[model samples]
Target: MILFRGTGAAACRYLESDRSRADDYYLEGGTALAAFTVTDGGGEVLATSELDAEAYAGWVDWIDPLTTKSMGKPRLPGEEGTTKHGSPRFAEMVVNTPKSLSIAAALHPEVSDALDAAQGDAVAEIRRFIALHSVTRVGPRGHQEVVPVERLQTVAVVHKTSRAGDPHRHVHFQIGTRVWAAGKWRGLDTAALFKQQGAIRALGTAVLAAHPGLAQVLDRHGLTLDPVTGEVAELESFNALMSKRGAQVEKNLAAIEASWDEAHPGQEPGPVVHARMTAAAWAKGRPQKRPTTLAHEDGWRDELAEAGYDPELFLQRRLPAHAPIDVDDLKIQTIASRSLDRCAAAASTWTRHTVAEKVTRIVTEHGVRATPA
Candidate 1:
């Protein structure tokens, strides 16, 4: 799955890369943690490719990246109660690996390595999508027009688990909102990113499913990606087993809502207030990291063993060898018909994007890929 979060300048508190202690190789701009790093491309504006605490502070606060001094303009009379520069500092896209994939990674090093490579490849593809669709508005009010721009300022932080300590492997791909377009810093046109979340999720999962190393590893371990759901084909039952974190959030939300109803005595909250209440509930529900003597991966293994999952049985060839699929004209016609029907069902108005997303859905669900020359 993919999640896009709009963030103000001060995302560093949680957005900072995990700083675990281990034997580490140094990166170009800064030190490397086991999981991720902060990078910078140029020294001018956003400077780093990885996450930088000081530079990020400056970047979000509208200060010079090198100088770390405030460059924020004095607010205009009407510009009260907004971000430092009246624009969000960054947009975060979370690319999450499937639960079964995460469990597989914990079970084996080869799976872990393959998962990393697949995730990297998928992230690169998503970046290309961002570069192609990124835009900025130029000119005044009614006369304004959107122009394509580049968003080179990106930081990806790979995380291993959810706050509730589930085996959730994901990357936080944060795109800096400061885009250099037409010799000026401008806010990115995030409408594309927001509007195409489903497409992004589909594309990312498709890449994971077809990745050679990852696919080979899965096959060896008697696993395969479900063409439609894009999760471990044999592990549908894992959903109920692995939804601890999400379940906690839901439980907390219910409790909070109950309390709110009691306090308010029959008053219904407006949309804005309800949204804030939900946010508060999430934060309240978020679990703090519990200190563990055993290594995290080791702990996951123990849990799996206790759950009665036999590794030997898992390794045995379970999925059948591929049978020849007849991709005849009728199959093509059926796919087309289903794609169009899905588009119609999804929206009243249709555009190229809508059709494209629906087609992608149909293609992925069937595990279809472009024929190589």
Candidate 2:
């Protein structure tokens, strides 16, 4: 599974701070640095600065000074803007654990390499998907045209456990806000990116399925899968346990929000305010135990069995066979079908030519070459 969330300066600070643990922050493709230059679509350096709390809180003025003044509200350094609504300074793509591989890695430390390989493949797929799908429109009115963003710069941070100290392997991909395209920096068309998230998740699952050894490990561990969803139900208990801290934080936030609403009357707080509140709440409500003890394999399996999931069935069941289809073609077809379904839902009619044109535009926009018939 993959989740997307827009983050503000406060959140960015939390990620870079010691609170998140320095060891978990991974600098993909290079070593870590205090500050770095933001680049344009052509890979030209735009600005050099550290993306610490100060930078994010004061970024609106630097990024769009004219607009900041016109709005009549100056954002203080370290303060998430209270008036700004839709402008997200950064985006996070959370790559979640594949149940089978996660369980395997937890039980047998030796399988960590295979798990890493699978995760690497998942990340590569996500990067390719982003390259092809990341786009923005340019020009005015009728002259508007869609163009792909040529580059994506992200810091992929891997975490070994959930906030509740449960064994949860995931990556937080911090994607830069300003993307390069058409010889300039432009805001990413995140709506399009969000639309393709499901496809990207499916692609990750497919990549995992390609690794037979991982599946065999799942079988050995007694993790049964749902015949229909192909998802392992046994992991739900673990997920629920891991989610306790997060659930508490959310509860605290909800209470805070309610109090704020009561005090503010007709006014609604912006994303910045919400982010600040959420962060504070999270910090205050964090569990006392920073690290959790890993259960023995036999004990973990017993717990799963106690949760009513049959371990015997997990051992007997086999993973569904991979469908024989070209991965690229499958992606294209899936996107096309989704597009058609949306059109149908909207009661919009399209001729064959129109559908073909739409698909062609998507293919061209993403730089996907058509497979020879």
Top lDDT hit: 1
Model 1 segments beyond 4 Å from truth? Answer: 1-9, 16-48, 62-78, 81-86, 245-295, 321-337, 369-373
What does candidate 1's lDDT look like per residue over 178-241, in tens digits?
5667767666677756776666666677667556567677778787766556577665556555
Model 2 pairs in collision: 41-180
lDDT of 2 by residue, 194-278 (tens): 6666566555545554444444444466654332233455555555543446556546666776787799975656657765665
Task: Give the top-scoring candidate (TM-score).
Answer: 1
On the 0 to 100 scale, the lDDT of residue 322 in model 2 is 35
Query: How much lDDT does candidate 1 score?
Result: 0.59
